[model samples]
Target: MKGDLSTLVFTGCETSGCEMSRSRQYDIKRFCFQTWYYDATEGRCSQFWFGGCGGNENKFATQEMCETICVEPPGRGRCYLPRVDGPLRCDQLQPRYYYDYTKKHCVAFWWRGCLGNANNFNSFEECSVFCKDVGPFDEPTTTTVPPPAPQNIQQFAPTPEAQQIDIVSAEQPQQQPQ
Candidate 1:
């Protein structure tokens, strides 16, 4: 599979694996890891949980890899286009970011999850990076918020101090009488 993938990548062939659905193989051990996959229909890379076995080549180690392999490089004019929320028929509402040519910065918006133009990006950083050179502004005017973490990935637990504060707050001393 590795050899075939290398060949396909080097030859610039359309890899059928990009069209495969995210596969979380069922295993007794159940070793799951966060991974990225190319969503051919949406024309973007998205995060998915991989069971660490029996998945297709669509699984990429990083979003950049998936985009490099599956997505076409954006054309010169793509950055100047207005934000598109995609068609109304698709109900999946995904939080996405796009470069606002007028605003001259990246802004977050809800994408309808299909057929949006290349202006749409998975994160503010991505949109900014791609459109920075193309836009009228020399640099983004607004402060950037870090992109949301992947849904399937586990977030860090609260700090020990925070937990202690919560415990103390929960155990308010009982007052005897007024």
Candidate 2:
């Protein structure tokens, strides 16, 4: 994370309530997509944060990018459009949840589309371009409901000694070199 780069395509707002750039990294075809950075803050995706699609706002890659080619897209799926235009403008889609380590938060977003290429390339930067093209939309399956955390709902209840545990657990535990 020392040299981790923050991306912005247009004004470069450094926004985009997203992370998992390093976690959801995947292969869409010949390219590699890596979620290298997660947004520690949110308001709007910077120019690079909100990538542009070949089509309207309906089409967007995941907020998290894998590479330049590979990306999460709004594929042909049965999506339920909400009465009110929800956060993801696509329609009514189920939200997917991921534990973000960099942000130390459980992030949520709707799956809107598929990876552009489908082939996994080498560098994590390869698939990042896909993120540049896709923006937030009506994820065919998604919602923005972060699982509830422990708060003092009872006024009389005694406060616990600890606040909460860090939810960001690395998939592969790091091993120390001998």
Candidate 3:
């Protein structure tokens, strides 16, 4: 663990002038993979990556593959979701590849890209709903994360190579809003 703990920290959401508050464990809001907001900086995606999977093993749910269709294609968002159902959601989202909220994980494939994420959300169901309503993925920031000193897993920052989320930005014929 060599980087700033604040980098991975997430703040709650403020919407419609309503301040939404949640305990560290359960907060209803959205978070981008990058610590700094890119859309705020510019559409330029400056995310750096060594590797990431959003726990989704299926090919169709890949945000990168689906970018061609989704209006706001999910970028590296899947990696953080942790709970998915089917093939990665790609250019043309197949229903079978759709996320199943009840499974607490993806259904047909190694991942569903559906169930709410444990890494980011409160419950498996919450993670699923969040992913289904909002795109589930994140872009890796370029900052280097030195290898863990091996003292504490809780203190360890994920390897920089392990930070990149696999996803794309594009519109598809069948993809729905994230």
lDDT of the candidates, in the order given: 0.61, 0.26, 0.26
User: What is the per-residue lDDT of model 1 for residues 31-96, given as tens digits with 9 covering 90 to 100?
Assistant: 777889866556567898777878777788888766655554335345544455654455556788
Off by over 4 Å in 1: 1-74, 138-178
Worst 10 residues of 1 by lDDT: 164-173
Weakest 10 consecutive residues of candidate 3 by summed lDDT: 10-19
TM-score of model 1 vs. true structure: 0.38
Model 2 per-residue lDDT tens digits across residues 1-178? 3422232221111122232222232333345422233222221222222222121221124444322211221321001111111222332233344322233222443332222122222222332332323343222233336334222211122236455433342144579999
Ranking by TM-score: 1, 2, 3
- Write the residue-wise lDDT of candidate 3 on 1-178 in tens digits: 3433222211111110001111122122343122111111121112222122331111122333222111122332332222222223212221222233333333322222332222233333443455554443332233222222222112123455887644432334477799
Which candidate tops TM-score? 1
Would you estimate the TM-scores of all the predictions?
A: 0.38, 0.18, 0.15
Which of the numbered candidates is closest to the native, going by highest lDDT? 1
Collision count for each candidate, in order: 0, 53, 45
After superposition, candidate 2 runs with Cα above 4 Å error: 1-66, 69-89, 109-178
